[model samples]
Target: MKHNELKTKNELQEKSLFDKTVGRRSFLQYAGAGAAGIALVAAGCKKDRGYENPVMGGATLDFKDDFGVLNYAYALEQLEAAFYVKVASAPPASFTAAQKAYFQDIQFHEIAHREFFKAALSTAAIGSLEVDFSKIDFTSATSVLSTAMTFEDLGVAAYNGAGPRIKDGGYLLLAGKIVSVEARHAAYIRDLISNGSFADLNSLSAFGSNNAGGLDGALTPDKVLPLAQPFIKTKISAINL
Candidate 1:
């Protein structure tokens, strides 16, 4: 699909006053419109059995509407939940008792976020994704904390970027709530690595005057998908956010 075409269509939809007050039922209806076709395509793919056969091709995300945006968030949440689950299950040997406890908390939060999106999207939600974490050293504290920071930061940016694309006020509000949590997670992880770097100018880019607080970065779907693609085995293409 043409990027400009989809953007124009989304803009037109956003311009409608009716879109702003869309209820849950109407939101699901709009989001689930393309679910059947995508599900059919996904069902045809063979599932992988174990770690050796990690990579498996799957349905690409259809970024045709607001549903697409929600699914995008759902996909990222799935990846994060899976990662944190693994970490919490077997924390790095070098991690302190406090670190282990903090990681467990993060794991639960990510799981909650993942399940919430799944329920919100309902039939429109994508199937379970296959993840590839081969590059991460599970036994290394540095590796684990660094990756957590990356995911949390990316998640905050993703929601910020996608907020305007969500036509339904309810969905946007929910996204805001979730992103705030993600931002907190990012801060915690950052502080774990380097004290007082939670809202550092590097991760949270500064705006306005030098004295002004740093603003978190926002990344459109096109930008976020590439950074996240490596950790996911399933194929995902936004073409254009």
Candidate 2:
């Protein structure tokens, strides 16, 4: 929780726009032409678990050194970017113009985050992973925003939790800088969905705690995998610890 400020409970009501009967054609029309492109299809395809792990398995990521940590951040950025991309693409059935623009800006921000991590990681950056939006079932506004909120909040916690684990101060600094920005993003989205409820204790952080003012649950890599599993195509068997 950001503390000392929050929206009244009565003002925090927002509706979700999901219904099984919704048609893609009408939704596309609502989303506008910029999102109708088929290129997003190359992002993912289903796979059999087989002998090799579907998620690249392991306790660590691939880069091995400082690069590995950077790639880890990069990987997370990819997930966030992909989620926002879809939100901007299909849009909610009853989305307002302002809401739509906010989502679109988030899409750009996620892409920028992804690219920035890649640029910083340099050669250590992993190849782009395929995204399986099929698993998301973004059929309505609630589905889209709630899922995004989860991921965005997860991102904030992940960075915060990972900060202390990092050995290099430079890398730590980068993570610190970026995570603050991510927290801002999280707060904005939360507010968009609910007036002034951005950093409420339930999610924004634990009550009666000093630094626990952002989010209560900070997902470790293991917990994150399952929520993210369906959307990610590449195996993530850990390589670097």
Candidate 3:
């Protein structure tokens, strides 16, 4: 569709500006880490098959290895983005005007995140992912917000857990940047739903121990795929990383 479907797996893996996951704004802001010999991507290295924009898609993505991991993130952002977009487009009957505004901002943030990953993953990016809205219902703002909370917390911990394993400085920098922002977003939303409550910090730390950031708390591609099954229509089998 964009440039004829990525005909080969190698083409899908090739590095070009288009195959990236994060955007320039996110890249510049988050790339504070060492350069690590990686250069920024140029435009249009190779386009994905299903959509004109890399962020838009219709099929399942292949989340294998580091590429898989990035695509996994890309997919999640897609889900979040779509959810918020729906909320913004159609506010629930019970939602207050103030609540609508908050959700709208949340939608914009999630879209930014989705685009960020699309740009960052460029050619190495996965195909457009198919989602199942049935797994989630935004009609009830509380239910919608609660599901969002789960995703935000999961994203933060996943990034923190994956940071050390990244081989490329560029990738790691991107993760830290997005993860930090996600954390801030999470805190803001948590406070929004319930102010002055400890729910702000989702279960990352307990007992004041820093080293307790356990691997089990983090969802690898494999674990996340199954978790996402109910919300997605595609069969994601590439999370071998």
Candidate 4:
């Protein structure tokens, strides 16, 4: 199938699941009317201070409140955006023109997300994180694409897990919007790697035994941070998350 056609189909499937699980009206309600105070309230929460960073020898994630959650997301986005920036700047030798183009788009999206979180968190946002991509072979399509798939899938799951933890409705809505995009990126990358593994049980868990609505694969900060650590040189302490 063509790219647009495939994207449309994937979107329809996601919309169906989202509608069944969390109605569109409900999601809109969560977005709420006030936006100006959302970030202020998020950042004003009490913070845990004085944790050591093992890898880069700096401060660790406070994880005392919602600001910690946003900072956590900021750290992840920084890693992702950096990876994609590298990939887009120097694509693998085996990559096709279309593949390079698609990666570039993903790179732009990630950078946008990173900037958004940075701006939203403002002074509370964590500093730039140092990443270790030593395990990845950027010259090889297999390595690059595999890593991309991992990041996109992990991002989706991370957002899913963090959704309930966000006390601010506006932040939840922001996360929902971003995760939907991440899910689409996951589906697109999965399709590029394998014909139809996007929503496969092997890639994503079912909502429940009934398999009626929504999809599963949410990972809390504790579970997610460890998996992401290998690619990051900065030590993160999500103990309080």
Q: lDDT by residue for model 3 over 1-241, one digit each (tens)? A: 3433532333343334233433333334323422221122212111221234333434444433455566777777776676666767787788888877667666655665666666655676666656677756768777777777767766666666556556656677667777766776677667666886424333444212143442224545555556666776656665234
Model 1, span 135-210: residue lDDT tens:
9999999999989988988898889888888887766876887788788889899999999987675645521112
lDDT of 2 by residue, 97-148 (tens): 9888777766655564565555454443467766666756676887787788
For all candidates, the clash counts are 0, 16, 20, 0
RMSD, model 4, all Cα superposed?
13.9
lDDT of 2: 0.57
Q: Which stretches of candidate 4 lie over 4 Å from their true place?
A: 1-56, 205-213
- For candidate 4, the clash count comes to 0
Please list the C-alpha lDDT of all candidates, in the order they appear: 0.70, 0.57, 0.57, 0.69
Q: After superposition, how far is residue 155 of candidate 4 from its true place, in Å?
A: 0.6
Whose lDDT is greatest here?
A: 1
Candidate 3 residues lying further than 4 Å off, grouped into runs, are: 1-65, 198-217
Candidate 1 residue-wise lDDT at 30: 29
The deviation in Å at residue 50 for candidate 1 is: 13
